[model samples]
Target: MIDFITGRGLLLLSLRRMYELWVNHSSQIIKQFSILIGLPLEMSNNSDSSLEVFSPAKFPKAMNELSALLEAIAATSIYFKAEIVVSYIKSHSLRIEWIEANPALAKIVTSGLLKTFSLETLFEANRNNKNFLRDVENHISKQLLAG
Candidate 1:
């Protein structure tokens, strides 16, 4: 059982690392393009355009594709983390067992959910049309799972 848990933990860590790299790389590329276009990117106030940023000229297909990819990754990470929490809750035969075995673990896991929602709010509030919410959603999803 210990080996199983350890292996899964390692796998989660690896996935998280990969997710971080992808998010960072995507941000860097976006920042580079934003600079090249001489645009000072700002958050969108509208929900429809929140995750995207736009300028007068059109962006390349690859850039749009990358943006979409970031969104997908964010969604996936969110789901993964949610599943882990649900799994943990279900695995505990008794509520007291969970509380007794890992008193702080539950609180920490619960906080992950709170943090996820917080990021979601940030994403929605910014509304920059840069797909920032999608990026954040992806990051939180992965983090929830790994944590």
Candidate 2:
């Protein structure tokens, strides 16, 4: 259908239609993601500023914090993501701070993850390798710590 329309010299029309579809779809997607990530979203009719896509502009801090937490789970996960990131920061005496976090780190992360991802989604992502999330955590700890 796209080729059919574009070949007939309705290229601008087709592009406009695709953009419309994208705007409609992305708003819905953003809303769902906001709920999952436990973030507030306010969409106003007068602004195109809210249409931005996800980027590392604000995620690196979150990633580093998450990496710090996952360090307790399995040492390799964070190292593999950024080689020597943890050790190098420590050696240089660089401090990475979290933005207003709870005292209970594990519970905080688990609650956020539970909100962000459903069991069905997790199972699908892991190809149904383990049925229980606790088992998954234990398995990683055992495997990484043993080796």
List where candidate 1 sits over 4 angstroms from the true fold: 1-41, 44-48, 51-105, 109-121, 124-131, 144-147
Q: Which sections of candidate 2 miss by over 4 Å? A: 1-8, 43-147
Find the 10 residues in a row with the least total lDDT in model 2.
86-95
Question: What lDDT tens digits, residue by residue, belong to model 2 across residues 1-147?
Answer: 253543545887787787888887998987787566433355334355324333223333333443444554442332222212222222212223321222233333334332223222332333333333334344334433453
TM-score between candidate 2 and the true structure: 0.29
For candidate 2, list the clashing residue pairs, or say none. none
Put down candidate 1 lDDT per residue, 1-147, tens digits, no spaces. 112345777878777877887787987886776555433444347656543543323333323432343343343334333434333332322255554555444454544332233222333344454455345445434544554
Candidate 1 local lDDT, residue 67 = 38
**Model 2 C-alpha lDDT versus the unseen true structure:** 0.39
Relative to the true structure, candidate 1 reaches a TM of 0.24
